[model samples]
Target chain A: MQPDDLSRHLAPILGDRLIAVEPFPETAGRVRFRREGALDLFRAMRDDLGFRHFSTVAGIDWVDHREAVYVLWSDDAKQYVLLSVDLPAGDPRIESASGIWPSANWHEREAWEMVDLNFDHHPDLRHLLMPDGYTFHPLLRSFKLHEPEELEVKARHV
Target chain B: MSEMWINMGPQHPMTHGLWNLRVKLDGEIVVDVDPEIGYLHRGIEKISEDRHYNEVITLMDRCCYVAGFSWEHLYILAAEEALHLAPPERAEYLRVLCDEFQRIGSHLMWYAAFVQDIGLMSPFLYGMRDRDLVLDLYQSYTGARMTYEYMRVGGVRNDLPPGFSAEARQVLDWLSRRFDEYDQLTLGSDIFRKRCDNLGILKANDCVAHGVTGPMLRSAGVKRDLRKDRPYSAYDRVEFDVAVADGADVTARYLVRLEEMRQAVRILRQVLDWLDKNPGPVMAEELPRWLGAPYAPIGREGYLLKRNFPKGVGFSAVEEPHGEAVAYVVNEGGEHPYRVKFRSPVFSNISAARKYLIGYHVADIPPIMGSVDICIGEVDR
Candidate 1:
């Protein structure tokens, strides 16, 4: 299951989920799907079909759109199957795959920190790598970079 | 035999990074271990949003400081994928050259740290001394000691300076001999071998189940490597075998890393030959280096831009020094990445502690941890 198999074997399955497969023109053997069918298709892919490892999950906000990408890796066949589902531009929510792969626990939390996506059914879904009560989703397109008023002055290492 | 909960570091050296592990110990024996992370979380993902596409090079350095160079490569590839840029053959070969050297350098540092975890200090010094040589090579190319921003989007930032290969050859020649010395000095000393041979035996099934990558997974008898399976850069062109060990123990893990360093040297020599023949542009003609970076700011902007920065979604999984490191880049497609999440190898590989550490003595933790070689920077990043 090398990268070549991704376009051939995984595309049809991903197409069925998003209802239509959108080719990732930038990267070969890559595609995107809609948000609705992400969970059910992911469950089938990870549990039954043997894409055992949820390699890495990423959530992104394109201002008018939100996305959750699940990269499912099958060690036996060495295939990488990607699942991308889109949400509305403002609010984002998706079912967590931590039940299928424990690695998702951190990935999902990180996605929440970056994009403010609420992972439903995520156990202990706190800010994994960001501060608690941090409001802004930095990754969102609308957010602008600001200058902190307080300066953290420290002695330079001599 | 009452079990008591003992807190280990938001700052302990053994715990590595800012992680706090609450282990229930029943008198020098580990009954249970619960790891708590997120003390050093700097909203890197949030900050990645505000920066420009080129600005990501700086943040990627912080992802895994030990293997900062490789993370730079990963981010570059991700950006290149997004922008549809392919590096010239010479640049790809140059990247493979540095990547292998950095891999060896990273493993050497890990070896030193692992030994220190098990209470060996002198070897740490020896390891660091050699590691600097690799860093010196990095400096020659990128002009920085620790965080080499050598890698840029389309390709590398610059070409190798003249007289660099002469110096690298001397260093690689020395590193080859040093690998043998390390084997004789520490591979199976009575104390080291006893702790490593069968302890932390993560079976083949467990390796896949736990998502262990690199030496740890290979030690567990799975011949799975992104480099081998999905050959990237010049890996498909190169002639180096994937190092694997079947023992699936701490010793096997140690051996796999040590041997990988030797194999890296082989790949480096081949790369040098390829570099000599191929001489052209280091970076893609389309993506310019002086996009916005003037002198490289590490000041107040680091805070204001800490959150609500760069925006886009790019996942970069590269063969870093410590197994597989995937940097999930989420951007609103702005100047910075909206979120830059590091899927560190240590996080999942360490989670298997319960499966390996239970029923073992407390004294065994250090050696088992040593084999894993956790770098707090990556763990915390």
Candidate 2:
């Protein structure tokens, strides 16, 4: 499947929420959708497009805005599809994809803790790799590696 | 009976690494499980943002100690794509050689540890003894047994030493014979079958829905291998079967991995023949000075000469010994990658612990997790 195929299939369901379908290497296309239509796009991709395998979800901090990228694989098409949504930096939130793909559960948790991207209505949105009560999101562009004094980690039990 | 939670790890022989497995038990049966990871989390992703593209290869080696070459190949493929550089064809063949050898080494390590978990002492010694030969081959070329920082961004750091293929062929011959001996020691014994068979049975549907992959998925009779389906590197030119078993149990997982190691030997044989017939440059030509120079000091001189390169995103998936490992490289035109994200297969596999662990006996945890082949290094990276 190409970018045109993805746009033709997703345009009707997403309408204006479907921002654009750009060509990405080694995959069908990169589907850029509005954050509001996140669940709808996920359903269409899984049910309609046959992308059963949920590869991963990644959060990229652009400083101005945050981006959540989802990689999916379709066995029938033998191709991968990239789904990306940009959330506001001040309040980066989007509907969780775990409801559609259970595999997205841990990926979402890692993204939330790493980049501070909130997935509303997530089943268990606790700290995954980070220690509990750790306030800082290390993957953020603003989080400097050289600043050791700024780091404060709290013990989970204590 | 009332249920109570017990922590099996953070330090336990079954865990094989640092991480706690909090299991809720009703009598001797496991009612539920909560795996607490992050004990080994080093924030390699955050550090990748500050390092140069070639320097990231160092971390990839440490990603999964058993499967270092596979991770290096994964990162290199994505970085090369992001930088708009194509490695020489010989480099591609050499990489396939490294990957196949790593697969055998990793599986042997798994076999050794797994058999010992099930109370088989002799097989453990045999597994480790055979794995050393594969490590010796790696030391000959890469110069390191565990953390081989041999792979470069554009290509490999160097070529094979003199008569390396002949030495590797001997190891392959020895391993192929040892695989049959392994089956006799394990499959031929009644204790091995009684412990592993029908234990931790996760059906095909649950395996997919829960994101379990690698030998676990293959053992469930799903013939989905990235090497065959996606065909990265020289995998397209190779001829090997995707090992599969329908049992979806611990014994079935053992069968699948043993077969996969045999197939890895088959692939290495072809790759070795090709490398011998075609001798040429390993690294790509005309690379940017900073990236092409292997011994260049990590200082301002290299950074100052950086040209404005076209920005691109490179995504690559490789069938690591553990499972389907992916690396995403986002190059926003600079000396360092803007962002590098990796999807470790074991991360998802371990997250689905509840799906398979529940309904099994507490005594069965060791053998069952052993078959899963949990490598915490990659999972917590």
Candidate 3:
């Protein structure tokens, strides 16, 4: 099925959850959906939407807004949906989508490490790409990676 | 059933890369598995933010060090998409040829490792000997053995200098002969067959649900090949069959990769023909340097293959030798990608380990794991 065929099939369920749907030209009718909806929308996308394959769950800090997106790709449907969930800039917290998709287990933990987000129901959430005691969210635009004694000493490539 | 914590290491012979799989075991059988990662993660993502587009190929080279082309291929494809740069037809063919050779190399190693895991010593020798031939082919062209920074943003870093086609032909000829010997040694062997065939079976439904792709998925009767379904580069030009075996066991997985190497060789032969006919520009016009690439060379000659990338979002996912390699790049109209994510093959394949490894003996774990050919750099990355 063409990507935009979802609009005709399940527009009622998708309602205002999807903000914009555009057919990417170079990608051969591959559609990108920008979503801003409740946690149930995330659930439906996994269960009902045929986006059974969970690609990635990560965070993006937009200076003003710290947002996390769950990118899901449905091989059966040939569509790409970006579930852009809004999280408060200060103390970013949201419900984990791990219960819905099993692949999100590590990706969610990575998000929690990088963006400092609290996943309400993420079982065994911990530091994935970083150390346990690493407090600062390194991916943030504001966070300065000031050069110290270690990076200078451990420099392999000049 | 007594429950006990079992740590299958950040370092183990069966396990690849640096991952500590904390398995809660009821005696020898596992109850639940928790995969702990990041032991070997060099923070390539964080480092990429400060580098240039072309220079990042070095980092990409290390992503899956065994099959380096697959890693760099995905990165460059995403880079091409981000910069709206399409490689020349000849360049695409060259890339595909190298890719196939790398696939052969990876599968050979995997076969050898799998055999060794299952208490077969001769098969491991047979596997490594054939693999070295493939690796030798890579070394002759690329000038390095393991990690090759051959793939550039718009085109390859170095072109087929001269008579590379004839050299490639010689390698393919040797590989084709060696493949026959390998087939007789491994597949034809009775002991290997008894251990592998119809063992650790993964059904088609389970394969789809777990997001398993490549030979493993094809072994499970899923005739879905990204090379055929979504033909990128010169794959569309060449006509070849996607090798499928409808047996979802260790043997089936073994056969799939084996047949895939044969197909890859066939593709290389065809691609070499195309290369002979077409010898022209490899890079695209109007290159935009990527902001987030590493610095290269001495002096201010600046970065090689550096282009200012368009501030947009583009994703390139192609079926690598191992599995589907997806590279997601987000450009904020800057010198670097604002964010880049590599969807590694090992993630899904390793996740499916729980399904495959649950009921099998600890002795069977190695070959089963080896069949999937998990690249640790990819798993943690």
Quantify all predictions' global Cα lDDT against the true fold: 0.72, 0.92, 0.72
Model 1 interface DockQ: 0.42
Worst 10 residues of 1 chain B by lDDT: B288-297
Query: Residues B31-149, candidate 2, lDDT per residue (tens digit)?
Result: 99999999999999999999888888899988898999999999999998998999888889999999999999999999999999999999999999999999999999989999988
Model 3 misplacement above 4 A: A1-3, A25-49, A77-86, A146-158, B288-309
TM-score between candidate 2 and the true structure: 0.98
- How do the residues A23-68 of candidate 2 rate in per-residue lDDT, one tens digit apiece? 9988999999999999899999999999988989989999999999
Overall local distance difference test of candidate 1: 0.72
Name the candidate that leads on lDDT. 2
TM-score of each: 0.86, 0.98, 0.89
* Tens digits of per-residue lDDT for model 1, A66-113: 877777677666656667778776558877877767767776777787
Docking level of model 2: high
Lowest summed-lDDT stretch of 10 residues in model 2 chain B? B293-302
Which of the CAPRI classes, incorrect, acceptable, medium or high, describes model 1? acceptable
1 against 2, candidate with superior lDDT: 2
